[model samples]
Structure formats: structure tokens, C-alpha cells
Target: MDSSTTRTKMTVEEIVDALRDKIVVQELAPGVKLREIAVASEFGISRPRVREAFSILEERGLIERTHNQGAVVARQTAGQIEALFDVREVLEALAVRLATQNAPKGTWDVFRERFGPRAIKAIETNDMDYYVEAVNEFRRKTFQEANNEILSQSLDRLYDRTRVLIQRLVLMPGRAAAALEEHRQVIEAMIEGDAVRAEQLKRANIVSARRWFQDFKKFLL
Candidate 1:
């Protein structure tokens, strides 16, 4: 029996995440065809659900749809990475500022509860994936506190692609501890209702990360 005959069932979101992870880790290289029928067969899902997952991946910039070739993983260039980081820095900084104004009481408490100790633990143990997850969760909480759907959606679109770039940045020498401290400052500013200060701290944090990527690009690329 052909191994391809076996199938695994998963929800549409699960399928999207699975495919996105593959793309992020370069398991699915750029320009590889994503045949809907084959994917549907593998996942034991319908073509329609697979299509939905494709659209989601496309929106996240993990894949692209051609006029006739269907979907393939998106190829990113250095200039594209620069532009994405520029836009992300501005938008995420704005998110923190808005969050200062709009955040509900106890929001910072919840964020701290989820990330503070866990973030430090991840860094000390060299647990890259766990650290990245904590950072992403922190970003999500910032969006939620900001209470702006449009801003949140815009940032969401860039996040998956950004994650691909930063997968290595967190592991850079001295980066993990610095990032934790930066996040702490940003959260403190938001809790103090200091919009301008929070925005500045957030932008500085993002810029610092971008610089790390620039310095390390020789190895990463």
C-alpha cells in the first residue's frame, strides 16, 4: 500500500496552522505547489476546507495564489523584509499606545501572569519555541487591549511572516533577556496609562530586534 493512502483528519484552523508552520520552518520551500486535492486527501478534509486554509495562508503572506497555478509558498526578499519591519514597528508601537488608553483594568495583570515567569524560564533553559510563543501571546494581548479591529487585523497579517524572520533573533546572544526587559517596560508604561512612553518603548524594542536581524542576517540568510 502507498503511504499516501493514509490520512489524518484535522479542522480547517489546524490545517492552516500546520501548513503555515511548514512554510515558516522552510519545510515547504517557496514556490512549491500546494495542490488542494492532495492536501485534502492527506488531511482527510474536503477541498472546500483546504481552499479556506489556502486563503488564510495567503492573507497571512505565507502563500500566494496565481491565476492558474493555484497556491504556492510566498517568496520573500530582503527589501520585503525591510518594508515589513518598518510597517510593523510603526503599527505595533501604535498598538501599545492605543492599548494604554483602551486597556481594561487587570489586563496587564493577566498578561504578566501568562508571560513573566514563563518568559524568563524559557530564556534560561534555551527553549526557543516556548519563548517565541510567549512573545506572540504578548503581542496578541496588546492587540486585544488596544481595542482596534483594523489595527489588530493589519498587524495580524504581518505576524506570521515576521515570525519566520525572528525565529533566530531570539536565540541571538544577550537578546532573550533584553527582550524580556523591554516587554516589561512596555507593559509598565501601559499600566501607568502613559501612551507616549509605551509607544516609544515598544518601537525601541522592535527596532532593537530588527537591528539584531540585520547584524545576524549573514548567518541567517
Candidate 2:
């Protein structure tokens, strides 16, 4: 009798992703109950597998199982968002820096342009889909090429927590253009194999995002 969707066979990972996407985009807003039975039915999976997906989502801070409410979507406070940004700077800076040295040649040529003309058009048109995909692509590819399992694992969780915030960040006036340029510089550093420079640029970008989040708090919150 609870919420239901189309049923399909899916792996545990797929179930997690489907739920995560809904949560990130606010379809599964904070405090909404995620019934294990309902989700299991929707995904055509066993209850234990749904539990496994819930465990992963909880680890990513996207959900919490309350005393009586069971598992529900989680909401972040302003303080929590700031904390995520802090950890993100360190992890992502190291990620980009290491990617510079570890990524094969030409690893960044596509990204450099993605953050260029494609990003520009996306910003101009206010295409959130393209922006989101571009950002995810860069993060995914950068970590994959970074060749550091520990760093990648650390970042994977942090990225999930702050992913929506970054999406929200672009909505601030002029923030999208600023972010596009910042990403371009970071990509340039990676392309040149300037690890230190890449790291610094990435940190600067996070710093700017944090500052803007504070400055334009009303818009973002």
C-alpha cells in the first residue's frame, strides 16, 4: 500500500544507484520513509539485498534508520554541508594531483573541452542535466585514472554527500561560469602533469564554492 514503482530485476549496486539518484534530485526528499518491502518489490530483489543497499546508502549519509520511522531519507544541516566541503577539498585535491601523474597521456583532452564550450553552452542555457553529467564524468574519470584505491574510496563517499550541493551551487548567479573556468584550469594542470598546481587549483575551486555557498546561502539553502 506504500509507494511503488515498476518492478525489474536489478543487482544490489543498481538498486543503490536508482535510490541514490532519486534522493540526490530530491525526489525522495528528507524524512520520507524507504520501506524495505516496497523497495524490494520494486527492484524484484530479496529483502536482504535491499538491506545491503540500505547499508551502503547509510554509509554515504543519504539515509538513516530511525527508532520507529525505519529507514528514511536524510537531510544535511548547514554545518554538515560545510564539513563535507572541508573533507572534499583534501580528498579531491589529492585526487586531481595524483591523476596528473598517474593518468595516461591525453586523459584530459576531452575534459578540458567538456569544461569549455560544452560547459559554456550548458551554463548559458541553464541545462542542469548536461552540467551534472559533465561534472560527474570529470570526477569519475579523474578518480579512475588516479590509480589510488584508498583515495578513490574516501572520495566516493564524500562525493555522494556533496554531489547535490555542487549541483545547487551552479544555480547561483555567475557561479556556473566561474566553476567552468576553474575546472578548465584544473584540467590544464592535469594535462601538463603539474601535480602541485593541479592540487592547488582544485583546492582553490573548493574554497570558492564554499565561500559562495556562504555568501549566497539564501539561494542555495
Candidate 3:
């Protein structure tokens, strides 16, 4: 992303990576066509390679083929987001519950500290990098120690295309602080060895986030 990969000769995988980054960053907005020939010219690659890259991106649900348009950035729908969060809420809450009960002692101490008052201050100043990093790290450690194969696979696949959306959701007005506080409560419950309370708090957190998405659907959709 620091370098322009669009003007360079790229392999199909590289082209896919470049385009995916573009879509995630909203440089290629939803429903905007990505003509194969145009992309080939942009990347200084063959049309066939561009087509191959399109296929890969389509498989990842980043883009879709239309009647006349070769490929366009996929549009996100409210219904789709609801369904995703529905399943995610259950799976993630269960994961936290299991991890809290199973992880070795001191496993969540770092996250417990990370989600403290300092994170709220960062959110107040509109700095999300620190908060997002902490959330990602907390999730990584939770899933790592969750020790549930079914939950791990399900949750990983569910999260694949949600990175961008999650970032956007957290940036909503008053959302960053609310989410950090919600996460802090979950972490506190885990630290206290209260798996049931942690699970409930996590589920409530997901529900709160889903409501935020619904409230902002006009802007997002």
C-alpha cells in the first residue's frame, strides 16, 4: 500500500492483492465497474492475468460480475450485515466463554490493561490505531486459547471480509468509546474468572454493535 502496485507489472496474485486493497480502502467504491482491459492497462499486465485476478477476488466476495460490467465492488446490504452479526454474536460469545474457562492464568492480563482508561482517552482524541490494535490482539489471544476447533474455523471464515466494515463501525459517533467500555467489561469478567458473565457481556457487546450498524445504515448502504 505504501508503494503503487497499480502501475507495475504484476502477477495474478499481486493484481488481486492490489485490487483487494483498493476495494477495502474505498478507492474502488461499491458498484463501480472494474473493466478487465482497463485494469490490465493500469497494471501493465495481460488481460488474461487480470481476468484471473478478478476470479480470485470474486471468490473472496470483494467483487462481483454484473450483466454488462465485468466486475464491480460488491455492495453491502443491511440484511447481510444482520445475518453475519447474528451468527458472529453467538460464536464469539461462546469462544470468549470457553477461552475464559480454559486459557492459562494471566492470558488476558495484557488485554485487560489495554482496554482500560487509557484506551478511552485515545478514543476521545479520535485515535483508533491503539484501540483497534488492542482489540485485534485480544481476539487473537482469545481464539488461540479458546481451544475449540469448530469455533475457531467458523469464526475465522466469518471474519475474513469484515475487517473494513469493523473499522468503519468503530469510527461512528460515540461508538469507539462505547465499544472499548463494552470490551473492558468483558475483559474484567474474564479476569475475575467469571465465564458466564464474560459470555453475557460479549454477547451484549455484539448486540450493541449491530444496533449501531442499523442506526447508520443510511450512510453505509
Candidate 4:
């Protein structure tokens, strides 16, 4: 065993990222308490550092802070989830519409090349993590190509919460294939310059996924 050690101090952002990963993977499920001292001990850091991380996570909608209870993982009720999807459905529909109309030449071509195959490959290999990453990447590219900074920023707030649910959704039996196919159809509409069709397809996909959550909330939420 080595006696000497050299370790750099972890930044608040690093701590936040680590905690966020745990939330995303459901290792720290919704409503789990996050005690500063416990976390500090686990990370070999001070309590103040963990507090800073908790503040950032709270701002990002991944954690909620209560006066008496301190911090707990953000828990979405069915109503909260439904309301989020309502906003997301509208915003994403607009994003798809705008992306279809405003994306620069070859943008969709590049996106399809980069993400479409990877999503299918992820499904074929049953790599749910990779598929989730691919799906998230596709969303980032779509928002970027939409060229609406305000819209993108607004939806991003929802993403920190929505993505957690999406991970669960994608892992359900038969969902990966359905999601991949839905995404491919949306991309095809975008590439073909059918803004209406693209928007419709994107909204439908989101709404359908929302319904799945509604039906399965007992296990999912």
C-alpha cells in the first residue's frame, strides 16, 4: 500500500456533475435526501464544497431545497410531468418547425449522418445508455440548427428534469425501437423540408411518450 498521496481539490462544478449523474442514473432516485456532510465525506471534500454543489444542482432543477429538510432530489408528480410535457411539446414542435425551415444547407444531412445511424446501432446492440446519449445529441443539434437561442435556453431548463424520465422511458421493453423509428421519421420530415410534418411528428412523439409515463407512473415517477 502506498502511504503518500497527492490529490487536487474538486471544484463545485465537478461535484455537481457527479451528483447529477447519480440522479440521472436513478442511483439516487427522486426524493432521496442529499446530506452535505455525508456527500462531503464520500467525496473527500469539505461541507462547504458540497453545499455549493447542492446550490448549483438546485438551480438546475435536479434537486430541491427545503427549509427544514435541506436538499432532496427533485420529484415530479404526474401533474408536474404532464405540465412539463405540455410546455415541451409546444417548444419542441416549434424547434422542429424552425429547424426544418432555418437549418443551413447540409445541416440535416450531417445530423442524419452523425446521429441517426448511431441511434439505430445503439438499439441493435441494446445499449440503452448510448441510445440515450444519441437521442440527447440529436436534440442538441436540432435546437442549434433551429437558431433560436431563447427557445433553446427555455427548453434546456426542462431537459435536466425531462431527461431523467426519458432515460426510464427508453429502457422500457420495446420503447427503444419505437423511439428510434419515431425519431427517424421526424428527421426524414426535417430533411425533406416539410416543416408542418416535422413539427407534427415531433409533437406526436413527445405526447406519446408522455402518455406512457402517465400510464406507468407508479413505477416510473
The prediction achieving the highest TM-score against the true structure is 2
lDDT of each: 0.83, 0.86, 0.84, 0.83
TM-score of each: 0.79, 0.87, 0.79, 0.79
* Worst-scoring 10-residue span by lDDT in model 1: 1-10
Q: In candidate 2, what are the lDDT values of residues 32-88, reduced to their tens digit?
A: 999999988777677888999999999889999867777999988889989988999
Instruction: Tell me the tens digit of each residue's lDDT in model 4 across 34-82.
Output: 8988897788777877888898889878899989889999887888889
Clashes of 2: 0
List pairs with backbone clashes in candidate 4: none
Q: In model 1, which regions exceed 4 Å deviation?
A: 1-18, 25-27, 45-56, 67-70, 110-121
TM-score of 2: 0.87
By summed lDDT, which 10 consecutive residues of candidate 2 come out lowest? Answer: 1-10
Candidate 1 residue pairs that clash: none
Clashes found in each candidate (C-alpha, N, C closer than 3 A): 0, 0, 0, 0
lDDT (C-alpha) at residue 183 in model 3:
95
Candidate 2 positional error at 218, Å: 2.9
After superposition, candidate 4 runs with Cα above 4 Å error: 1-11, 41-46, 110-130
Model 3, poorest ten-residue lDDT window?
1-10
Model 2 misplacement above 4 A: 1-11
lDDT for model 4 comes to: 0.83
